[model samples]
Target: MTTPNNGDTVTIDYTLKRGDGEVVGSTQEVGPQQVQLGAGQTFPQIEQALTGMEVGENKVIAIDCANAFGPRNDQLVIDIPRANLPPEPAPQPGMALQAQQPDGTPMTLYVVEVGEEQIKADGNHPLAGEDITFDLTLRDIKQAA
Candidate 1:
């Protein structure tokens, strides 16, 4: 009955859902997610919840938007001329586009509105501004090397 501790590697099966019950993500349909505790690999709140939990332990935790993905920043929403976009694939609402920042860092921009002249792109995470719940099951724990 070894309890998980900081620096340990742990595997978990989880379903992430919005407050309204929409499933955002889940490992149950695929495989357990493996992460290193205290290594910033997963959400801090999730790490905190798993602290001291033994193998096979399960719990449900709720996290607010600020603690999860942070609030949506309106400044991240911008309108870019349609001419600036690539000609292929034809941009449409709901499409995710990969873009580089002024600093050359990569980021994802979601298409919010498509227009003849300009398209609106939102850089906020899809789940931003929403509270989420995680049904987590600790499947295994490996001690840190």
Candidate 2:
């Protein structure tokens, strides 16, 4: 009956959903999520919710995009010349393409439209600007050193 406090390690199985009740993510499919309480590995809202839970506890969390991945930025979506794309992949609309930032971090861009000479790329997080709910269960809790 060890309850989670700050600095404890907690293992959880979670499912993420949209406000419309659509499933967004799940540990039941990808495996349970493991994190250290108060270690900043999760969203602040989520961490706050786990403050009092113990091993085997389960809870559902609802949060807005600002508390999740943050709001979407219109500027992140840009149009790039089609010629910039590799000739082999043959860019197509709706395709998820990997683009890089100036610092070399990889970004995911969806092909909004394939034009005669340009392709649209959006750098927003897929879950950005969307309100989401997370259903999380604590599978394990360990005390910190």
Candidate 3:
């Protein structure tokens, strides 16, 4: 069996879990993912691990907080005046809202609290500060043509 190398297109089935074992992401629903190794399509660590493997090989990878999503920033937790939010739909906790950064870049903010005067939203990724795990299975690999 040929092993995967840089620039090789690889098909893999993967499930991502948080440190608490919470299932965060998986390819089961959408099917396997195709990524070209060393192309930055996936995490560098994961790509390194996929460097050598045969088809149908299964491996579990543990990524630290720094490498996974990086540490959470407390400053990202901000409270916005309720008056600034839309009055029709109303904002609630656990809602994902689209917002823009000072640089005009689009971002997703998660609602953490809904108060009478303000709504607390977090700009940090939900998985930030958590060490994550990846369960990966190599399905196929094609050498770069």
Candidate 4:
């Protein structure tokens, strides 16, 4: 049995859940995912957990909120004048908008409040400030060349 190591390509099936036990993401919906160990394609915590795991092994990894998505920042929630938003499609609560930061990096902002004069947007990840868990099954390993 081959064990996964850094640089190896591994196939894994995983179900992700929040601290509240809410099922947030799963490979069942998208199929097994291939991750390149140490390539930074996935979370570092996951890569660490996969190290030395043989095919067909199962493991559950827990990540705290700070290490998962980082803590939420109050400054990330900002209110913009309604006039600044595009008139088409009209901004609505729960809508996600693509915005460019001052540094030219793209950011995803979620609409939290739609007011008559101001629209509230939160730049934090939806899962920010929440602990997450990953139930993983190592399905296959392709040894690095």
Q: Which tens-of-lDDT digit does each residue in 1-145 have in candidate 2? A: 6677888888889989987889978987888878887879998778888887877788899997787778989999899997788887888877899878999998899887788889888788888888999888888877898
What is the Cα-based lDDT of residue 106 in candidate 3?
98
Assess every candidate by TM-score. Answer: 0.92, 0.85, 0.89, 0.92
Tens-place lDDT per residue, model 1, 1-145, is 7888999999999999998999989996888889899999988889998887878888999999989888989999999999999998999999999999999999999999999999999999999999999999999989988
What is the C-alpha lDDT profile of model 3 across 62-129, one tens digit per residue? 99999988999999999999998889688988899899999999989999999999999999999999
Question: If ranked by TM-score, best first, what sequence of candidates would result?
Answer: 4, 1, 3, 2
In terms of lDDT, model 1 sits at: 0.92
Off by over 4 Å in 3: none
The model with the greater TM-score, 1 or 3, is: 1
* Residue 127 displacement in candidate 4 (angstroms): 1.2
Please give the lDDT score at residue 70 for candidate 3.
96
Cα lDDT, model 4, residue 78 = 93
* Over 4 Å off, model 1: none
